[model samples]
Target: MGCTGPLAELGGGETVRRAMDVNFLGMLRLVRAVTPSMAERRSGCVVNVGSVVGTAATPWAGVYCASKAAIHAATDALRLELAPFGVHVVKVVPGRVKSGIGRANTAQIAGGHGGKPREWGMYREFTAAIEERARASQGAGATEASALARHVAERVMRPRPPREIVYGSLTALFAVLAASPVWARDAFFARRFGLNRKL
Candidate 1:
């Protein structure tokens, strides 16, 4: 299952919870719905589309990143659980594929659906950064959705699909970030997202 929602400020627990529900729990539900049949048949392939951001949390989109991280972890667990049943689980990590997510996220932010970042207690000055993060995928270098879909389709159809697939723009960047030390990663993201700015 591949899907994504907007980037929103986690002003209260509700926003975070909602993001988790959509990104992580939604995948859980889909898996639950199909696992019984797949188990019975002793054959099936479950493909989960995650994000490179999930590999390492970034400044403005922490909640979204957390949700994707949960997917990665859960996908790993599910792969092991379904192995005995001859089920294959694949995790697709896309960095930034061209899609409507950017527009949707921008609209959500504009509609103040997640929260008013400008009104946030500690994150007020960084709202612009948050907005930028939400819309970052729409940049020129984003991978085409059709291309990503084709690549994933071919991989999943293989006799033994890869447990994890990383593709798209910024995948390499996120890979470097994922391999970096926590302190270094945090510092880089903070500076990039303007969290280090003194307003």
Candidate 2:
């Protein structure tokens, strides 16, 4: 559940709303539906899949990052809330994995406006960078989906699973950035995402 576009665009609000609806509300609905039974039984685990982007906002995918951040925050809250009932809530933050998300996002953008970010106002010069950001997670160094799944499954099946599982490619780097000073983090993202230049 993600979206790619400048935050000031014509349809930006719609994009943000859709991302939140799918990524946050969708997960919340499922959790709500199952938690009552789990609470009554005094057993069960709720694993929420989040992303490294949730920890730190990136340039073009702000809305997508926000959605994942919501998941991460909710997972943390739920962990404490459901602990007394023996329900374990785990936050799975994957950095980057070989998934269909990139393709889906590309298709979504194409379907929305012919995949032409160059035509967008104020962001025209950033077309290439924006396009790259859209597919950034699907790069060559991305971890295999099977590998991530295996690691997560193994840890989760343990006698006591971790409160949060952080795995996949670039997880370490993101962790560092997440802990870095706000100014430094901002500088790093600006340079990395081609936002350092004047438009």
Best by lDDT: 2
Task: Give the CA lDDT, 0 to 100, for residue 28 in model 2.
Answer: 99
lDDT of 2 by residue, 1-199 (tens): 7688777773556667888999999999999999999999999989999999999999988889988999999999999999999998899999999998898777666665555433568888887788888899999899999999999999888868899999999999999999999999999999998999875
- Backbone clashes (count) for model 2: 0
Cα lDDT tens digits, model 1, 5-105, are: 22343444565677778889999999999999999999999999889989987766767787899999999999999999999999999988998877776
Predictions: Cα RMSD each = 3.3, 1.9
Q: In model 1, what are the clashing residue pairs, if there are any?
A: none
Full-model lDDT, candidate 1: 0.81
What lDDT is obtained when candidate 2 is compared to the true structure? 0.88
Give TM per candidate. Answer: 0.88, 0.93
Which residue pairs show collisions in model 2?
none
